[model samples]
Target: MKSSMHNPHLAPEKYGIMDGISECIVTTISSKGPNAAPMGIIKNSNGIKIRVFKGSKTYGNIMNFPFLAANVVYDPKIYTMTTFSNLERSQFDTIVYEDVEFPVLKDGISWMLFECNNLQKSSQSLVADLIPVKAKLSHIDAVRAPNRGFNSVLEACIHATRYQLTGSQKYLDLMQYHAEIIRKCGGKTEKEALDQLYRFMKTNK
Candidate 1:
């Protein structure tokens, strides 16, 4: 199907998305309310795709509404929070289209609102092709040097989330290895984020 969004090329460029896997905080409407989760959006020559597992809230929300907003944020705390638990309502800013209120992170650097064009489902997950319908460049001047600590925190958080879903010992081991790197290289934010992740994991168990 032809894209209904205008100037899609320009928006992706402005969002710093290219032909690779961009990790984002994707927000969608849930029966309870707005929900957010960490998702990897794949942008390739074929186009953008995201695989949402069948059991996830994201998958259910998309099946119900077929729209999402992918927020580009660098805050490790936000990632940790969303991965492990629900984000506070105060953390979101709403954008309405077609009478639907979509949540955008308050600290997001950029965001892309997408309509699910074609969804191919399996027993495990739904692989949806995305069409960018709207976008915003929230901050043009936010820049930071690469921090290994921050990167490690993200890696650990991913494993933590996986561990929760699968109860896999392998993911737990991976999180432990990444924790060492966070200790050696991460700053205050990375350390605190990891701490929160661990706390959430333990309490939820």
Candidate 2:
């Protein structure tokens, strides 16, 4: 599907996103209202694919409604909240398309509305084929440059989540390595995010 909004910065190919995982906050509306989660999006020539596990609120909502929004954000709090807890309704705003509900993160840099065409379900998860319907670039300038500190924080967050799930010492070691990088090379925001991750790990451990 073609997007109505034109965003030069949405050129995934230029950012080397042709085939890799791009982290984003995915929001969907359920009967209970809106829910958000951190998701790693797989982008390729075919389209964007999202793997939503069965029994998850995201999977259930998309299965019922077949529409969701993917919001690109750089906020560490957004990542932590969505991954560890549900977001409050006030944290997001809504955009209505053809009466279809789309939840947009207030702090997101960009957002894309996706309509699920096919759902291939496996024993572990449901892979949804997403067709982009609407997209907007809110902070084009922000994403124009590369920041190692920010990237490290995102990578560390992924490892931290994995460690939480599996309690693997390997992931914990990796998380600590990334934390060191954040301490040495990260900026204020990166350091702040690292602190949050450390606090979470201490409590969770």
Candidate 3:
């Protein structure tokens, strides 16, 4: 049987979490308050994994707290905004898991609570092989359709991040992919996204 909106590709949804897609929003409280950062979570034969950058607040939180609550969310625009602007929007949920206040998506259909069983640090990033202590879904209104807004933003951000490594090939590929989505879902749904990508390509070049 086909799983709802089953992606033909192995790498989950463009912006959100999907099977084989390793992503998480790192939220932790310091002496000040709470901070949220995006992370890439993975799954392998052994267990689940999370990758964090070196010298980042997310890195510090995972190190100090050593336990984290991961949420599978459906907001690609937020991810893009955070990645490009390094800012957190006001629309998110914070809950107490274990001894920490975990940031979650209020609209997400599910949530996972994991204890940091293994934490690996390196010169470039942090990789944690987590052990799932508890996990379940919080039923909401999520369906099996792709979020056009998130897809567009993710397409733009991924292109922006990979421009140097891939060069013109990446730019062309990204623009063309985005253009196709615009044609299908209609540009009205992705006006802001299109503008952002265009501005970056023009100014950054």
Best by TM-score: 1
Q: Give lDDT tens digits, candidate 2, residues 1-205.
A: 2234333445654333347787888999877899998887899776778998776789898888887788888776677667667888888988877665578887788788777767898998999877666667777677436667777787888888788889899998888888788888877878887888778778777
Candidate 3: worst-modelled 10 consecutive residues by lDDT: 1-10
Q: Which is the better candidate, 1 or 3, if ranked by TM-score?
A: 1
Which regions of candidate 2 fall more than 4 Å away from where they truly are? 1-19
Q: Evaluate all candidate structures by whole-model CA lDDT and list the values in order.
A: 0.86, 0.77, 0.58
Q: Which residue pairs clash within candidate 1?
A: none
Candidate 1 Cα misplacement greater than 4 A, ranges: 1-9
lDDT digits (tens) for residues 108-170 of candidate 1: 999888888788999999999888887889899998898998889889988987898899999
- Angstrom error at residue 41, model 1: 0.5
> How are the candidates ranked when ordered by TM-score, highest leading?
1, 2, 3
TM-score of each: 0.92, 0.84, 0.67
TM-score of structure candidate 2: 0.84
